[model samples]
Target: MASTTEYSDRESLGVGSIVGESFSILFKNFIAVILLALAPMLLSSIIAGAMVGADVALGVADPDFSTSTSVTTWVLTIVLQIVFYALTTALLVQLAYDSKLGRPLQLGRYFSPALRAALPIAILTTISSILAGFASLALIIPGIWVYAVFSVVAPAVVIEGAGFGGLGRSAALTKGYRWPIFGALLLVGICAGIVNFLAGVFAGVLADVGSWAMIVGFSIIAALSAGLTGISIALIYARLREIKEGVTVDQIASVFD
Candidate 1:
């Protein structure tokens, strides 16, 4: 019934409320958030580092990136990274809902659904990111707009079990609120970006040729950033459903049970 309602009949997206709730959720579950995201991120880095080798990632030596072999390796690394990113995002989406609902954080229960959704999420999200990347190459604003359009793919896929249709679902939900959504994401992203930058600088501590400190430190920062970003997206998705379809968070979280 609510889904049949027009956009004009719906409420505002409430960027501020979503942003506040995202920060609250992330702050309250800070350690758990980081840990939930750490494994996939750390593995991604290791896999990418192994594929590209120290010469490329650390610049310890000059390797011809123009070579076909090197190009294939880089592409493979990107694909793997996207898969891990999707997996991490999927995990965090479940955590966000459970945490928001004040439910016990059963991290294990989350994995079953997350793993089931990860492949489709990875595929659709790769398409979204590639589109965003191309738009970014043309201009920055278009890239942000494109990203905002599909910002909730992970949550939609995992929660609604929408699979490949997640992209369309996100696009539809975000249609009228892309700018506000982008604003909310950018505000939170700036905060996370600042921390990530500091961590990057701190990672330089006694580090050269991609030392363990650099690897582990950046991975930790990335894990934290991923956690915050994923939580924001989850909250945004829930808010969008509430605004446009009169759906409650409880209704959305019910799928996990």
Candidate 2:
């Protein structure tokens, strides 16, 4: 099941190549990818919207902003997001692996590996998020830097079962290739942002007519954006392994068995 497609060698990929390859994979497996990613993405969006609604409610109902409800909502949203992102990342990585190896793209078939590795993934994702947050708080550049280095962490968790050690694995994979990774991520982000912006614009136009329609519009956009991000990262993870470990797509995917 070795792929005929040649991924870029370690440290050899440019931003354009990464972006192109990601979109290619995404388009090729559009339905499977979207379906696999939909649940987690939509749940996360609902949780996010709840968090916002909670804050708004607190502001309106309790002007002092001294409510336990706000605190609880914040905590719940953060925890749920950590789980959602981790599971979705793991699922998407497996999907990308199967896609690369020309295996069946059954959305249901990918869930077992994701759930099997759920705890470790959640832990690693939470840590990565915290570290990135701190980096951003210290300085924006460092935060972005940390994010790029840890971009492969989900793949590491899925393929190597590196758990929390996936952080180190990701950093090693990206060692001298940080710039390309960052560039690739930035381009993807810009594209996702553009789609999101367009969606928001459409939502706003609907908002003047009905709030529920706007909510539905934004929810669809959020889910689509999340799915796109997951697929792109999965592709990146596969490419990183090919380049850094000199592994074929099938060899890396064998970890699932």
Candidate 3:
């Protein structure tokens, strides 16, 4: 997995290399990535807050799921979170390729394609996530494997226009490389988890501060987490394509142009 064999002639799926480059691309375009992620995150948070009190949605207050309002709040929040996640991943996929190619970020043009693909990506991602969640109930490793198998879904849907078939496309691309992909994702996931943990602590501290402050704080952390995860997944998708298809980053970015 780490080294290329003469017979294979494919690029090496270097886990460390992909993880290292993901961080480079992230920090290099940190502001842009965060900003791109923030919009959808904040909007979702605001909507959730409106349905249930901001305090309840942000965990500052107890959630009374017994109430109908609280149940609706949970449902709407979960659905919006998935939709926003799909949109964010779609936006970042383009940005990651552009960042990798050293092209100026095109903030304005990203939304059209991202918006167009968000629902399908959200639907497919929801199905995969549900499967992963169930697998995790029996054992954690199976869950992670399930996630790795369909990990490149958003990139496939957004970049290749691979609608509902994105699941099959991702499964195809990831074949024979699931473990390496898992390793790369695990390393990145740990880093993201740590950051999110710290963000939680920060949110806990802000609980007494005020509603708006906590909203801002929570949105920022959510955006940061999404930015990291989305960026890494985008890179992984590009790397997989390059290794399997001999496609260059420039060629991948050309889809947005």
Q: Which ten residues in a row have the lowest lDDT in candidate 1?
A: 1-10
Candidates in order have lDDT scores of 0.82, 0.71, 0.83
Between prediction 1 and prediction 2, the one with superior lDDT is 1
For all predicted structures, in order, the TM-scores are 0.90, 0.80, 0.89
Which residue pairs in model 3 clash with each other?
none
Span of 10 residues, lowest total lDDT, candidate 3: 1-10
- TM match of model 2 to true structure: 0.80
lDDT of 3: 0.83
What tens digits encode model 3's per-residue C-alpha lDDT throughout 123-187? 99888888888889988877887898899999999989999999999998987677777778888
CA displacement after TM-score superposition, residue 244 of candidate 1 (Å): 1.6
How do these models rank on lDDT, best leading? 3, 1, 2
Model 3 backbone overlap count: 0
* Candidate 2 lDDT (Cα, 0 to 1): 0.71
Q: Candidate 1, residues 111-130: lDDT per residue as tens digits?
A: 89999987898899899989
Cα TM-score of candidate 1: 0.90
Per-prediction count of colliding residue pairs?
0, 1, 0
